[model samples]
Target: MIKSGITDSRSFPAVSIHGDLVITGGGLSGVCCAITAARQGLKVVLVQDRPVLGGNASSEVRLWILGATSHMGNNNRWAREGGVVDEILVENTYRNPEGNPVIFDMVLLDKVVKETNITLLLNTAVYAVDKKDMATIQSLHAFCSQNQTTYTLTAPLFCDASGDGVVGFLSGAAFRMGAESQEEFGEKFAPSAVYGELLGHSLYFYSKDTGKPVVFTPPDFALKDITKIPRFKTFNAQESGCKLWWIEYGGRRDTVHDTEEIKWELWKVVYGVWDYIKNSGNFPEAATLTLEWVGAIPGKRESRRFEGDYMMTQQDIVEQRWHEDAVAFGGWSVDLHPADGVFSEKPGCNQWHSKGIYQIPYRSLYSKNIHNLFLGGRIISASHVAFASTRVMATAAYVSQAAGMAAALCIEKNILPADIFNQYHIPSLQQRLLKTGQYIPGLVLQDEQDLVGKAVISASSELLLTAFPGATQVTPLTLSVAQLLPLDKGTVPSFTFQADAQENTVLEVALRSSSKPGNYTPDITLATQHIPVHPGHNVLEIQFPVELETAAYVFITFMKNPLVALHVTEKRVTGILSVFNSVNKAVSNYGRQTPPEDIGMEAFEFWCPQRRPGGQNIAVQCDAGIHRFKAANISNGIDRPTHQPNAWVADWNDPQPQLILTWSQPQQIRYIDLFLDADYDHPMESVLMTHPENVMPFCVRNYRIKDAAGNILADKKDNYQTHNRIYFAALVTTDRLIIELEHPSATVPAAVFAVRCYGGEVGQQL
Candidate 1:
């Protein structure tokens, strides 16, 4: 150990370690940052201050994992986070359905241990940083209490996902704390003037019934009068865990420096509240309930927010602005709280929901001044209002994943984060993220490597005629609804649609193509036709001939004057979906009156019959059973999960589903990556409950891979989860590859998201 700063007055002992990237946090975002970088073959040293990996969601704090889904409520449907967040949620729901905090710890720890490139340092707190120059970090110094050893870790890049932006703060990076003035960012939701007040911290408790009489003894520090608390009216004895997020404090001062004091104050409130429930309870039902646990550490909400190239504002979220460098997306409402917390007479929080998902630009994930510094989680660059929406665990994880990948690319290409976008590597970064199964809203994965995209693509079944037996009656008047129809170069002469008119109505139908291939909704109008319809069930035909340069989606819309009842079928296609929009209604959820329905945020989601795969689509087709859920989705490189139906699935009656890939010439391949459908019926919520099955019913439980020569390459009988990567023993050059799938149950079908193949030499390994 080389000691430099040693004098007669003072001596310091230092130990040195080296890595490519150093992450100073073990929270969800930090864990994801380390895992993503490590997976890309970068040596990462993750130094977490806590004993466990998860920071807020750990046993010590017991905060539930909240994200873009907003607990599957609040109208933000089908927006669960992907990548590492998805993996953790699936594993936890399958293994520990009750949402046990201890089990959750193991799940997080297991994933970190599985990655060989990551060096984890638990109980190590990074408090200081060494800078090489004014713009870059050189090393980090952290103390591990368990080993009583101080570590000096050096790296080329560093990520401050420590929830408070500690590394960046110590390195003298520019940052902002508390709320900004309305004039500064022009955020209408912001305060009139700047202030140091923040969102505060929370500590939760857990309790369960013992089915017997129980007694509680209140400590001396417990508040004797519960009536004095403003939020006491909403307090319930049965409330535990996340339900107690309202019990917060320390927003009036520095949330980080005064955490210990805040923790003590929270303990008093929690115990006092429990005492009110157990002893002062007006009902006898609480006699059998006992306090299971209480958090000793407070889960902080906000502290020092690092400065980035872009500062996301409330206007950006409310307007749903699409950024050119958007690498991740968020949909959670802008949830801001009063600084007084529980002591305040006001409600716990103020929330403003978005009409749809919004983009989080990559520019906000890296430091503005420190060249090699990247920050994520609660500390990313954003105003108090914008941070309110992006501070959730899952959104932060996505940002962390993007930052880690960008760091890897920075090392791989030998450039800075800003240079990545400057050199036109944003597309490359997005492609890598998409290939890895992270869904970026409004972005399509046009995989050039997918051989199917090169050929004349066709499906086994493209037209959906039959609606589910129980269909919802939707009468859309003045509003238009449309579905994406994948059309080839061949002209589609005409298409049929089903509708039940209450009375005589004139229906205007139009065929529109997507303005851009990546966009989901149809923007450019191609043709229009008017059809007179009578009452009762009517099969209307609209003659529309269309030709495309490439195989892409052509949308057909029906506009009803008097709200004609449309029949929705049960079948849903992977890429094809139904969309609706109206110019009549304005956004009404937020408290403040704001202009609504911009051209971009005009599309509104409507619930249709949960159909069989491709069961309700109205399109012109050449074959009878050519299912729209085709093998092409496997190579399309989009994995939007099982619930959204952006995956390939077989017919229910088809006993065996076999997908075969053939090339004109022999191709050498070594790796085959598969993304299966894990049922997303189980929602992410604060309350814990178990689902019927860990794996989805339609998932391919049994599968086998074979070559054209009839040689078995790989097989698995009882498959589970959504992702699998299989590497062959040696490079196998073959023209044809076959994959046969079987359902776990006789009634269920089979499905897959993507099937990616890589080319390499015989000696190559993954």
Candidate 2:
């Protein structure tokens, strides 16, 4: 190599790439979008400004990824976001249970590079856009600072997921910066100017014990006056990283243009906080602690929100409104932080949860002015009130997956993004998304090409829920608890529960269910009964004289009684859980939310399940056994549980559990997709949270597929993912296909959600 002397201004190496789609940003949203599109047969170019992917979820920012599950802090039971994002989360849990930020970076990189159809350009920032017309982008000009190269990327479709809406801004897309007024969208929860119009930026740091005394010296620019922060007294030596999410700033200022200035202020705060912990006499435990990592950039919460065909409003989220063109769903609470951030005297954030998960329309995912531009991440069209709910990484990733799939369809049909919604192509879009394990609220898979619909399905043994053996452990009834039971459109089953009372007292039993059929809010009280208890063990029968109109999940609630203790079992089943009316401070739950009448928010008690190693099932016996887990459920079109248990669960004692599908005639099958249970109830936060197990306990660990002639078609071991697709080199003609499965744990029965088979030429992986 020879060194060249600079003469006139020299340009760096330039490269041009042409693809079917171009995505700006490497956050979870953009990364999932690229993966989804690439898998659907689109050539994609992904441009990320940072050295690593995941944006705020990256090692630099280190914010944990969350979505509808909401840390299992709300009533969204089995409400995890699906498709590519689910895969990423499951993979992270398997590889990095400790939630190491650096390992999470590797997980994202591994997922992106494995997609052969995607060209990932890291450390590349898109600075300019060339438009074919005023309404369409023709190409993008990007520069990679790390490699000193310039790239011109051209694509038929463009998605702006850059967090700041860089591509949308450069392309002249319609956008709004601050919150909308109450009169603008009839959103009573909309904040006033005095309360702050935008959410702020946050920086995080990590601290670790060195096993010895460690001294810290603050920089010259460090914040010397910690007392200036109104909430400085809340900080402690044990809390670090996102636990200090209230340490935010830069909301009143321009979030986009003043990011650098905002970051400096955050740095000063972090160093100052550390200095206070090291030097302040109150935190004696921090003597052995040292700063392990400090974020270089702030995690921005709000920036430019682009305008799409339809703008989501507060009612859409609070009312759980349905959309005919719905392609994705979100369940996180409407969380908004104070604009004054750390310097404010107000509470860190105000969060309001809905009764259930809500659907997101396709019309809100593409630009209104820029014809070829698609919006993803926090930039999707939504009012500030709605954005508070959809801004989380997992929700953004889910919405972006829908955008990516829509882009593939647009390229295949040679149509614009709006045409997909206008021309009645939404049903086809929903079906395609469902086939890939993307759950759209109130929608079931109706694929005509699936061969399982034509087959006769049978299982070795189906689980008949008659009783859960008790005498394992007794939990005090300090908080009201409920057992969720799937029921049919008939008389409600009478439950017999064993409980011990410290003194002679009356136990109140209530039967409740959500007003909506499929939701788990327990908002409607169907019936109530009073049962008398003695000082010793007593068997009590709870009989609800109510009849169900449709299949639903009913809750048998036992009111809190300090004198009573109920028996619980270790046995766990698919699509069944027990919840308590308790508070989880992390999600702002306080047992019951009592807002002022003028806030336009509903007041309700939070009934949520506890994390594993604690959330055991309430032991109960039914007068009549519920036989919903039949062999035919494997072909029911629904993958996850909704109003009822949609899975074919084997008997607890079945030694050789198998699911068989037999066609009338020999069918040539080349692809088989199996949907298993991954415990969707678990939030599986990507960082700073430790999980009880790497794999979900309900998952099928070992499985094998066999043909009519007993030939082993495919064998898998140590499996954890929910959706498993098996591809064959050549089509196998078989009238019968047998699936043998082993339960991951003896306590959890083997279960299969759905089985789909396809014949002929190989198409998309899904």
Candidate 3:
């Protein structure tokens, strides 16, 4: 059928495209996949049928982005999706807290366009696929309505992130729709028998007050008798936007085939509801209120869920079942809606939350029969009950990140996607994910090439000599004296101390060069100063100049003020000045800002002891056993919470805790990643809630990097939050390098999760 293009052909001209990866759908999941893959240096073609990106969360649907944390409710706590999804949440939280759908569209657009490797095709709907023996997809044809062009994109791999499972359907991938029988997955919430009816679609509207009397007129299509709608009995003019998620339809029929009918019905409901508010004369607030926007397309919920290598079940979520190949996690509740949607006489949806979070295995991301087909978003392989929780945009984003990374690795290894798991290739995959800041619960990364694992470890403070677990109980104690320091400087410049203020008050501090430098307690008061402080746990510093030539011991003392209290611990170290007993009174652990409840005395030591049970030394020094803070743990890649606590902590005397990586020979290192334990105590909030203190108080405020020759490489200062990873400007070859950290807060000791170095090996990137 080859015809001369100059005269004989009047048909639509076809365009051809090629890439390493082709993704169908432009929702949150597809966008995440494309960004991640393209950043890994892969050519990606992201095709979407919609005019704008962000599927249901787009301007067309206007649904708010909801995710695993369940709006920070259900005690899910800090369980927000932390990878690419977190990038969106953090950026949106900082840029668009008011939650404007239009602004969100721009945020997503900016993220996609910034990646040079991604070729985004908007308003291009893929309706057909070319498959190789029904096992692998070779290419797909899409029609771009905006440009009136037909494009065929070919790739080695394909992902069906389209919410409706359109690509999978054309490829003939095994899929299920609607509710399943209770006996199928043993799901308590499933219907007694299988049914094709599915969860319906929802429409939303935005309204604002114009501050003037506004008139209203109802179209003929508007529902005249609003009393027929049951949910409207309590509806008022004040409701609109996300508050109206209950405005739904199309669950009782084919969701895709009946989209027009569903949209028209939703229109009637929306206009009818507005008519009642404006003309029914029931509410006075409607007199000046005007409709800002109404969603043109309904945000559809449940649809075709393609079958994968493994299917997630409700039992797995409820029991928090562990998976060997787990690549992501979900904390959202098992949310299921009625087949009748808004018209249902029963409640719209039923939900049950998990105790914490459940694992999502990689097996659930690819098609069971198709060789190169992977899935993301709501269409991922799962039973109806399991799909309820994983369908949220945030949770789906994590799945997309995992799939994208896996695809990159698959291409690099010249292996099929399924071989990544079958051939025991998960360790490398997991490590790469963690390096990119994708956190997986209970997984720890161990670097075999870290030369610091062979060095001798030592510190400047003697208060770190306690056992790994430290004291079993907190003891009440107090400190009257502190460590003596011998410095090359003739004068003692400055020092910081931790104190708990019973109220807003001040504590008097005195520093003296110890006549007896070997003594732990203050021998002589050289200088006395008064320091003003605030309530709560605080680290305050005092500066004064007291010249003392030759070797000197600095003795510090505090006035016995009841308004301020210092921390005491049983953990002890050597070769540095320490605190001496000032007062001993047994007090309950209750009402204390910090913990080690039984260890606090009337007088306390300057060094704070963190409770850690398991860690191995990375250095060979005799005092290495005494220095409980292992340097190797910095890059072991386990991100534990403050309560569960897996962190490397140094004594309070040293402002800089340095991790030195040394080798017998030079080691080439081009990248250094530092994961600081940002004291993850507070839950992640999806709304505009601000805390009195910055997030992760224990995170380093500033730092400097130096090589063995004492050359400064990089000095980062005044940092907030945590650095996922920092790449060096160029490769450095040396016997050793050091990372020195400054405490973010005076009260707490510096904590770090991992310090990772990358180089010396080929192909080390995503």
Q: Which runs of model 3 end up more than 4 angstroms from their true locations? A: 1-9, 192-197, 236-239, 449-633, 640-643, 648-666, 676-703, 715-723, 735-751, 760-766
What tens-digit string does per-residue lDDT give for candidate 1 at 482-543? 76555555565466666778788788888876544433335567888888878988877667
Ranking by TM-score: 2, 1, 3
Q: Which structure among the candidates has the greatest TM-score? A: 2
TM-scores for all predictions: 0.81, 0.99, 0.73
- Runs with alpha carbons beyond 4 Å of true place in candidate 2: 3-6, 762-766
Worst 10 residues of 2 by lDDT: 757-766
How badly does each model clash, as a count of residue pairs? 13, 0, 30
What is the lDDT for 581 in model 3? 27
2 or 3, greater by TM-score: 2
Model 2 lDDT, full chain set? 0.93
Compose the digit string of candidate 3's lDDT tens values, residues 1-766: 8865567556566999999889999998999899888878889999999989888877788766666555433323346566676667556654665666777789899989999889999999998999878698999999998788999999989999999889999999999988776677877666433222477889888888999999889789998888777777879887667668778788787898888899999999899899899998888878999888888888989889989889998877766778988898887767777777677766666566554577898999999988898898888888888898888877887898889888888888888788889999988888777666677776765657554454443333322422222222221123343433333345555555456776787677777543322222233567888888687776666676777665433445565576766653332221222333222111111111122322111121222112122111111112212333444445555654311234466666675677666667777777776766543322333322333343445567787878889998778876554444556657777777777776665545566666666664444453
